[model samples]
Target: MLVKLGPLDAGRVADLRPYLDLVPDPRARRGRWYSLTAVLLICACAAVWGARSLDELAEWAERAPDTLLTAVGVRRHPLRWRRAPSRTTIGRVLGAVDGDALDREVGAYLADLHDASARAVSGQRRVIAVDGKALRGSARLTAARRHLCAVTHHRAVTLAQAEVGAKTNETAHFQPLLEPLDLDGALVTFDALHSVQANVAWLVETKKAHYISVIKANQPTAHRQLAALPWRDIAVQHTTASTGHDRRESRSIKTCGTADELGGIAFPYACLAIRVHRRRRQSVRRESRETV
Candidate 1:
């Protein structure tokens, strides 16, 4: 039978209970030995503390003190024999549950966190960066690699992530990840892979959010047109330089109000066009330059 972990105070383990509650139990009630919430909560806490695999998570739970298990909502067995679910139970429950639903629930929880943080800071605009990465250990065993689209803040707090199927790319999962997020007045940033016109329009018109996407050869015409602009004549320019790890890097950014030459294209609320040029040099004679 399903059970709820009632209101918990603001903390790491407590914050996860609401999201874990959304995961439907796939087990039959007649022979069930553990609640889904308790299993998930214990697993989440274990993962956060550096447990990478099911075996490791189970070991962590087994070694956990009774007080820690109780604090994380793990109930004592009716017979008072076990303080938490076994490793096999954790693996079975995780494998049987709906992965997509779990992802959505986690996203919703992070969105709530972002909203609360925004409120506490007096409406400060948050920066959400979208990127994709592949799981390191999953690639060797299967031809279909596991990739995930992660939305993170500038402060390095990961808000959410969505899985990108083997047949599809990050672009396919990009909008879906942002769909569940409340991005109003927030600035969303993405790499060149997501610099499509439709995405720009949707972010501005539908989501009512601002964006700063890198321009690249993916969109040939837009890249060429943006490159042809007379950036040297722009008045608003910012330049900075830094040196670290035997390398020196410098960047210059130029911004302009609007581009008359590209008037035909409908860029939603198109008020600014920016160009960035970067150069880097290492002590060993390696050098590179990039423009965006």
Candidate 2:
């Protein structure tokens, strides 16, 4: 099922006031022409509308109607006819704002939204995905390239993010991205890069949550052990099949029993060693009995 989020209303914009209010204004009061809240609201709205730079945000604000400005808490200017801030002012203010504080506030706001939505649709499991991405336009030869993020699977909302430094990778920053979240009853997922003993321990033991991580060749011992499991002998196996575009595919997944043959680097509370196999066939075959 797909849930479509509607357009943002005045009430929803007002909900962000408390969080944006926490961002300190670094500008001097004497020459301050616009309210900090108004500028932030404008930037946030512009960002939602796909504005990636300060100039684009300023252009969006310039073209915005008075109703949008007023709805976002922009008050009348004392001397000027317009209440919107210039692109330069927006850039300066944002540059001077504390990044860590802004991240926490935004993360908290998204978490609140997630919790409220989850309550509205009770009994459904929430899946949060952790991954890393590079800033497309901000790449530099000497600087680190990627930023780690924790996002929800369904709504694609980013709950938290941390920059991956030059010397460190996504693995080092994974735990910090998840530290502020309330993960109770949520199933977190990560790729093989994060499929380590520490992350599994934290998810299952410390947070009391469930997880599904890829077991890849990077973890040689775990991958080898899981691959050697007797999947055919397993009592319960799940199978799924699909056919489309002149091709047919089927997959079967099974879990191993609780035997100590795996090894000493055991995952905390680990009960299942899963293996999946996939087979595919095409509708058209060569005359020599070779399937393509």
Q: For each candidate in turn, give its C-alpha RMSD to the true structure in angstroms.
A: 4.4, 4.8
Name the regions of candidate 1 deviating beyond 4 angstroms: 1-10, 78-82, 259-266, 284-286
* Span of ten consecutive residues with least summed lDDT in model 2: 283-292
**Per-candidate clash tally:** 0, 0
lDDT of 1 at 140: 62
How many backbone clashes are present in model 1? 0
Which lDDT tens digits does candidate 1 get at residues 1-292? 0112222333756777878798888888897767788787777667666777899989988987787677676667777756677878898999999888877786677677767877799758888999887766667654766787888785565667877876778887777778878888899999989877888898888899999887777877766766776777776478999999989999988886655654522344566778788999995678999877
What is candidate 2's lDDT per residue for 1-292, written digit by digit as tens?
A: 0012334568878888898889777778897767788888888877777777788989988988888888887767666455677888889889988877877787778877888888788688777888777766666787645565555567887777787777778888877778888888888888888988887888877777898777777878767666666555676478788888777887777766645655423455556666666777774561112110
Those runs of model 2 whose alpha carbons end farther than 4 Å from true positions after fitting are 1-6, 78-82, 217-221, 240-250, 257-265, 279-292
lDDT of model number 1: 0.76
Model 2: per-residue Cα lDDT at residue 288: 19
Model 1: weakest 10-residue lDDT segment is 1-10
TM-score of 1: 0.86
Residue pairs that clash (backbone atoms under 3 angstroms), model 1? none
